[model samples]
Target: MTDEHRSGCPINLSLEVFGDKWSLLILRDMIFGAQRHFRDLQKGSQEGIASNILASRLKHLVELGMLTKRPDPAHKQKAIYSLTEASIQLVPVMAALGSWGLRWQPASEELSIRAQLLEEGGPELWNRFMAELRDEHLGIPAEPSADGKLVRERLQEAYLAVLAERGKSLPSKA
Candidate 1:
């Protein structure tokens, strides 16, 4: 981070703010995936970060105008967080990075499912999904889910099952 930069490059500034590994993960959680609170981000990430690191990253992101925090009506003491337009606009960046990871970096078949979902679904699906996330996070109108249409829940269930299997099938995976 100490590497000096003189001129003003937008990309350079972006990387300076969110170029690190964990910051993007936080964005991924909020925008593409389901994450609202501190605990959710920590539990869902594969690269386990300490509690202090997670707190610092959250604070950094808030300061960067990528996220906003609001008081939870139900829980007076706790704050429920959501993404700003700046962060939600990172959908393309998220899509590109996911595609890049699947291409160059070999992740598990299960891990690749998320990438596949975004890649195969294209922009329309991604936009709709992000719209739903925006609605939920912003405390706006939320679309009602079908009786049994559990998309993320199903994926998470499968991921948990994969964890329980624990190297039984994915010997080549990281």
Candidate 2:
């Protein structure tokens, strides 16, 4: 990473951190799919990211402070990746991008359901989801919800419902 930046604009600065084609998608997999290992991320990506690209992006994201990588205690040769606070704060941005994609892009219904809920739920949902992400990733406690179900669970349920409606099999989380 170099100190040289094209411009001082916020968008430009943010893009410098994650402007590449693969960075945000890697973050998306970590956030939505809970993929913490290199193999999981490489295998789970719908776009089928190549191993070298995945490795390079992971290093870049960690260097940018958007993610953390630590040795996994469970496996001797494996490392676990986790989203950092900076990346967790991108929920709204992700929501807005999803909303735009859903509006203008040809998106699959089952794949786009979470974005739909996030769009409809608006800031309220985004805040709650961010709180959840903070709790999960940063060890910050989020206030208890009235309904008790996790925000992710609700999103997953909606996703499953869409898959069921389409008669598609559930994709393995592994």
Candidate 3:
């Protein structure tokens, strides 16, 4: 990014930080999949992000205060990345983007289920999910759920169910 933004608009400022697909994807992986380590982020990428690009983006994110990186206790050579409070506040944005994709794009059922559920759940789910994110990344306590299931767990379960149904119905390779 340039030293100066094109405009002082909030949207413009946000775009400066999240304008590229890779950056958003990195954030998405961290937020949705909990992929923290460099290798995990690279492997979790659906779009096959190159190592150089991933490394560049990770460094950029850390520099921009979206993520924090430190030595991993499990492996001395590896680093653990954590989302900062600023990035944790992006759950609603992700949900909105997913919702828009589901409505306007030719998204598959298995991939679109989480978006569908998030849109259906609306702000309530978004708030709860954000709370859970805080719990995971920020060490903030999450609000207790009535059913004892996390919002993430619920979202993952829905995605898996859709995948299972799709697998059963799709023609198998011969």
Top candidate on TM-score is 2
lDDT by residue (1-174, candidate 3, tens digit) is: 565889888999998797899999999999988899998888778788899999999999999999999999999999999999889889889999999999999997888989999899999998998888889888899978999999888988888788787774432212
When summed lDDT is taken over every stretch of 10 residues in candidate 2, the lowest stretch is 1-10
Checking candidate 3 for backbone clashes, the offending pairs are none
Model 2, 14-81: lDDT tens per residue?
Answer: 99998997999998888877788999999898888999999999999999899999999999999999
What TM-score would each prediction reach against the true structure? 0.76, 0.93, 0.92
Model 1 lDDT tens row, 1-174:
345654478898889778888998888876645778777777767677677988998898898888888787988776777888788778767877888999999787777767767777778656666666667666555465565443456446666567666754432212
lDDT of 1: 0.73
Stretches of candidate 1 off by over 4 Å are 1-6, 140-174
lDDT top scorer? 2
Score candidate 2 by lDDT.
0.90
Q: How do these models rank on TM-score, best leading?
A: 2, 3, 1
Off by over 4 Å in 3: 1-3, 168-174
lDDT of 3 at 88: 85
Whole-model lDDT values for every prediction: 0.73, 0.90, 0.88
Report model 1's TM-score to 2 decimal places: 0.76
